[model samples]
Target: MKTDTLFKRAFNDALLLTSRLRDGDPIPSETTLAAELGVSRTTVRKILQTLTEQGVVAGAGRSRFARASAGEVQPFPEAETVPTSVQVEKQFMEWMLRGDAKAGALINELDLARQFKVATTVIREFLNSFQRFGLIERRPSGGWVLQGFTHSFALELFEIREMFELRSAREFSSLPGTSPLWHELRRLRQEHIELLSEIETRFQDFSDLDSRFHRLVNTAVPNRFIDGFFDIITLIFHYHYQWNKKDERERNEVAIREHLAYIDALLSRSRSAVATACRRHLASARQTLIRSTSDTGSVA
Candidate 1:
C-alpha cells in the first residue's frame, strides 16, 4: 500500500482504539500496535506523536503512554499531515486551475518549493516527470517556464492516450466484479454525481475530480510507459483546459454526465460498450485540449 494511505489507516485505527480507553489507561506499545495494524513500528510512532499533540495520550522519554485526563482529551486531530507526492501534484494542478500562473510564465524552483512546502529537488523531480511531454522547459541560465502545447503536440499525445485508454477499457471490461477497481470506479461514479449536483457553485473543483476519475479508470492497466504518459495527459486535459472560464459550468456538467455514462458502461462488463464510452469521453477531452491551446487568452 502507499505509505500515506497506510499512515492514515494507522492513524484512524489509533484514534478509534484510544477512544475506548479512559484516563491513565495504558495505550498499547508501538510494537503491539504495529503488529495489530500490520504496519511498521515507525508508522505507529507517527500516530502516537499525533495523538500526543492532540492531547489524546500523554507520555515522555521513559514513560509509557496513557489516555489523557478527561478534560485534557482533545478532539481528534485533522487529517493534515506532511504533503505526499500525490498531494503535491494535486496542489500543483489546483494552482493551475486557480490561474496562479499563466502559460509561458517563468517558474523558480525555490518559489515552488516554498509554495508547496516541498524541497527544491522535489519540485525539480516533478518537473522532470513532465519533461518528456515538452510542456515545461529549463533555460541554460536557470529556472523553468510553463510551455504551451502546439496543435501538433496535443494531436500526437492524443493518439497515444487513445491507444492506452482503449486497451485499458478493453481489459477492465473483463475484470471480475470482485475486483478492487470496480469498488473504486463505483466510488468515483458517486463522486461524479455529487460534483455534478454542485457544479454551479463548485465548478473549479471539477478539474481535480476529473483527474482522479480518469486515473482510477486507467488503474487496471499495468504498463509503466502508459503511466508516464498519463501524468502529462492529466496535467493538460484535466487541469489546464479549465483555465478557460467560457461556459465552464456547462462544459463540466456535460463532462460529469459523460463520466457517469462511462462508469455505467464499464460496470456493464461489455467490451464494446466500454470502448464506445471511452472514445466518447476521450474525444471530448481532445477537443477541449485543442480549443484551450488555440484560445489566445485562456492559458493560465
Candidate 2:
C-alpha cells in the first residue's frame, strides 16, 4: 500500500475490528496494531487518537482504549477549530507585534493571562519555551522580562535555520508521489496563488502565511530538536517583522511570488533546484529580520 493509504487503512481496520467487539472488549496496543497493519506505531497512535476524539474509542491511557457506545461520529465543528495553545501563541505574538508590549519591558503573566483569556499556566508555558533561546528571562523580583537581541543574533539563528531547511529540501526531493507532503504543498501553493491575485487587499496576511509556509517546509523532516528553534524562528521572522510596515504590501507581494517558486521547485523533486529555492527564500527572511532590527533601533 502507498504511504498515504497507510493512515486510512489503519483507521478503517480499527473501526471494523471495533464494530465486532463489545464496548468492554480490549483493543490492541499500538504496537500490536502497527505490526498487524504493517504501519508505523506513530501512525497507529494518530488513528487511535482521532478515533478517541471522534468518540469512537474511549480511555485516557494509551493501553486502555476500547470501543465507545455505538453512535454516529461527531463531525468536529469548524468554528472553535484552533487549538487553545495555538490561538494563545497567535494572540501573544500579535500582542507583541502591536507594540502593546516592548523589548526590555516586563511581561506580567497574570496580565497576559487575562489578555489572552487563558490560564496563567498557559502563558507561562508559552514564555518558557522562548526562555531556552534567552529571548525572555525571569526577573529576580517577579515576572518575565522580554529580551532584545543584536543583529548578530538574528543572523546566527538564520544560519541554523538555513542548514536545517536545506537538509529538509534534500529529503523532500526523495519522497515518493504517495507522500502526504505533496498534497500539503499543492494546497499551500494554491493558497499562495490566491493571495498573490488579491495582494492589494490581502498582503497584510502574508506574515502569517509566510510563517505557515516555512513551518510546513521544515516539518518535512523528522527532527524533534529543530522543532523548538523553528518555533522561535517563526515568532521572530513572521511576527517581529510586522513592527516595520515600510513597503509592507510590496514586500509581501514579492514574498508570495518567491513562495510559489519554492513550492514549484519542491514539486520538481530536484535537489539542486530545491536548494536554490530554499536559499533564496532564507536570504529574504534574513534580510527581513535585519531590517526589523534596524527599524526597532535596539540591540542587546
Candidate 3:
C-alpha cells in the first residue's frame, strides 16, 4: 500500500513534468528524473514504464518522448497520493485543533472514518498510537475517549522536550560550517524576519513555522525516538495555539523573536550560548503551555 502511494505520487509528479514539455520533447534520463523526484532509480524506471503504457510517452529507454499534451493526461487526485495513515493523522489533528473534540470526549471510530473518508480500522490504529501517550483510552465497549491536557502532563512532556531540544541545539552548534543545515537555518531565519514584519495579521501562521523550525533543529542529529516525540509536541502546540486565543498575537510575536535569538545562538556555534538560548525558549514554551492548560482546564 505504501509503495503504491509512493508510485502514484511520483507518477503524478512525473506527469506534471512531462506536461510542461512540448510534444515530442525528449523525456529526461532515468537518473535525472530519479534525482528530480527524490525517488530511487528503480522507481523512476517504473514511472517511465507506466507512462509509456499509458500512451503518455512514446518509444522506450533514452529514446522516450512526450506523446501527449497537458490536457491529455490527468494527475492522481491529491488525496489518493498520500498514505492513509498520514491522511488520517492530519485530519485527526485538524479536528482536534478546530475544537471539535473536547477533553474526555468519546472518539467515534465510525464517525471519524466517515469524516476523514478512511476506514474504521484506520481510525482505530491512529487512536491506539495515541493510547500510549495517555492522550486517548480505549473504551471497554469499544472506541476510545480523548483525555484532557493536564498540567502534570504538560510539565512532564516539556521536561523531555527540553532535554531533546537542548541536545539537538548543542549538536547543531557543533555542525561543520559546510553543513547544509546552515543553509536551511539561514533560510528559516529569513522567513522568521518576513513573518515578524507582518506579525499582526500573520501571527496565526506561527504554529507551522514553529514546528518547521524545531524539526530543522532536530535534523542536526536524528533520533527515531526524538522524531516520534516531536510529532506529539507539534500536535499539542498546534492545539494550544488554537485554543489559547487571548493575546495570541503577542504570544506568537514573542515566540518569533525568541526563535530568532535561538537561531542566532546556534549560528554562533558557541556551546554556552546555544544552551542558554535553548533553555530560555523552552522555558517560555513551558510557561505558555502551562498558561493555556490553566485557562482551559482541558487537560487533567
For residue 262, give model 2's deviation from the true position in Å. Answer: 1.2
For candidate 3, give the lDDT. 0.84
Give the lowest summed-lDDT range of ten residues in model 3.
Answer: 291-300
Per model, how many backbone clashes are there?
Answer: 0, 0, 4
Write the residue-wise lDDT of candidate 2 on 48-97 in tens digits.
88887877777756555566575865443433445566778778756654
lDDT of candidate 3 over 111-152, digit per residue (tens): 999998777777888888867665677889877877656666
* Alpha-carbon shift of residue 157 in model 1 (angstroms): 4.0
Candidate 2 — worst ten consecutive residues by lDDT sum?
A: 291-300
How many clashing residue pairs, candidate 2? 0
Q: lDDT by residue for model 1 over 177-255, one digit each (tens)? A: 7889999888888888888888879987888888887777778867788888888787676556545677888888888
- Which has the better lDDT: candidate 1, or candidate 3? 3
Best-to-worst ranking by TM-score: 3, 1, 2
- Best-performing candidate as measured by TM-score: 3
Candidate 1 residue runs with Cα over 4 Å from true position:
1-21, 32-56, 59-65, 68-80, 84-123, 130-133, 138-145, 149-156, 174-221, 235-249, 263-273, 289-300
Estimate the TM-score of every prediction.
0.60, 0.57, 0.70
Cα misplacement distance, residue 59 of candidate 3 (Å)? 3.4
- Quantify how close model 3 is to the true structure by its C-alpha RMSD in Å: 4.7
